[model samples]
Target: MTDNGPAGGMIGKVAVVTGGGGALGGATATLLAARGASVVVADWNLESAETRAKAIVAAGGTAVAVGGDVADDDAVERIFSTATEAFGGVDIFHNNAAAVHLARSDGPVADLTDEVWDGTMDIGLRGAFLCCRTVIPLMIARGGGAIVNTSSIQALIGDTWVPAYSAAKAGLLSLTRSIATQYGRQGIRCNAVCPGLIPGVRTEPDMLERILRRQPVGRSGRPEDIAEAVAFLASDAAGFITGQALVVDGGLTGHMPTYGDPVTSPLDAPAAR
Candidate 1:
């Protein structure tokens, strides 16, 4: 809806955004379409993906919806094939599909269950791996491409309660680096966008506030913030940058922690107060 129409950037690229039903994914897909890319919005939730694609079409952008589980090899192949058949070939891939429950308290290693860990890994890490594995060869055949993986602040900092989740994200970061290094010569560029606490469709005010307090900018992230970054990375402006983790946390990780005593913390230093 926002006349983000490619204008000059990505005027003829084909982009695929996994988990296109969710807030971040939806926004990313819409933004890509706006930027002049023919987008294939893939999600496990068919209705959601369809709705998003419809909205894009209504807004005068080009997009289509595809439903599939990124964890399944067959699904991945079929989805890629379908998108390629429709759009000729893929030029950008946003491997952003993730399955995480923020409400649950799985806690540390001792208390974590195999089921929970496996599910998280299967969706977050293995799923991304499978997507890249299937897409990279096709990308090579096309002569080049750009890939942006969605990582989290959790990957860089420790989250004791979600050990498996964090570990999976960390693995994603490493995987991204490995892909960039291994295929940069082949004209494939791989990078990651590390987000802080982003307020998704399910985020409540209390949760948002708590997350904001942790950031130097004092605000939880919005989907548009991420969309803009993705546009940059997917564009020729960032053609020289690859194998990097661009943290979009509004200075969340860069800020010093504040103690109970306002005098001690940088945010609450006497002069600031």
Candidate 2:
């Protein structure tokens, strides 16, 4: 059943957002904290994470920042340990951390180098695994909790350059399903969000161009949009939803590749444009 209360949207909860200094992660943390959840902004960039936490605290929301390398098992453990020790057990984990090299950025399969592929997979997929491994027991022990892993549309489609990133995100989708299948009876829920054309710091221009060319909405997604979705999945409102991959791409994926009529294509139709 769906819960409809003020606290239905993550109020009085505790949340950890990995890579919280970045646009998407920061947005999730801020939104959760704003709704009365104690947010931990964990990132490899310590200063940025602490700064974000400070901003949240200054705005009268509860927050703390911790630093760790997502690719390192020990670092992941310490991050969770800090969360439990500082604010009690974790009620929500936004497993949003990822690493992709701009030089070898999203591309065709043949161009991927061993170093780039391995590094990207290590952080994007393995790091997500490590976080879930560490947090699932705590969540089960505390009764139940929600996890939302950040994936990308690239996982399903290969229009981009980074093969490793796409593969890693695809793995995350399967991982979400596994968690849901294994622990749904215990009240643990896991899901993934496949965001499209989000405005990353260095990729904003490219992202904007893509949205303009193909996105039906004529704009790229904001981090706030994904954050709102995460908040819902973390809250009791989405108690019945699990192992779902919600694509927040403004109907981009729902439409046909070229539609029935290329000349009158919804994306390229002159008057519509």
Candidate 3:
């Protein structure tokens, strides 16, 4: 059909990317379209989505912008409905939206308020669930599809001051496995891309430096790094990869940190110096 041999595996596919206005999300949406997938760049901010969609069009890719809150059931439904109407059927869904700044509402377990927890879960956890529920049927109707959840390294380790954020991301891993196992026979693939130390646009220089020092790779992650991993999971290139949490953090979580201590001779190193 529309497949352009090996690389353009997504030639005739339709992709849905939530939070498509964000840095990482926008990169992912663009790359998918570049690889021959028609993308729906859905975001809560209409202007931002339009900007990303326009960029794709300028690059000779097919894309449309849709504005809607991922946490709102009605909005999510409208997002999918628009995609189906314009693109025919859904083949890939990237659930990337989250109320990340809502972390201000979080604190220690004792200080965690119901309001904060509710808002965090609603945006980070429930949003992905809502998108998946709406799109899975579309995938089924189209025979099969792929879903990529944007998880975090925080889910696998202890982080201070953001219990709610940690909990929400952990939920995504469970959701990934559940959907993959349950729908594997039906050709629905679910996977996660966990990023670490990806500094935001507003990240302070000092904070970014600290993140770079902590990361084993000696550098902070870029939006394109996450985009490439997402493309792999969504395309037939990763057909056998499912229900796995692929960490694309430049070796951030590869091993336990020893703070530069010599592995062989912690005591002898001081004496030799």
| Tens digits of lDDT, candidate 3, 1-273 | 132434346888999999999998999998888888999999999999999999999988999999999899999999999899999989999999987767667889998889989998998999989999999999998899999999998889897768898899999999999999999889999999998877886577987776675577877799989988898899888899899998988886776565434564354355653
Q: Rank the candidates by TM-score, best first.
A: 1, 3, 2
lDDT of 1 by residue, 118-202 (tens): 8888889999999999899888989999999999888999765578878888999999999999999999999999988787665
Candidate models: Cα lDDT each: 0.85, 0.85, 0.88
TM-scores for all candidates: the values are 0.92, 0.90, 0.92
Q: Give me the runs in candidate 3 sitting further than 4 Å from their true place.
A: 1-8, 260-273
Rank list by lDDT: 3, 1, 2
Q: Which portions of model 1 miss their true places by more than 4 Å? A: 1-8, 101-105, 259-263, 266-273
lDDT of 2 by residue, 132-157 (tens): 99999989888989999999898888
Q: Among these predicted structures, which one has the highest lDDT?
A: 3
lDDT of 2: 0.85
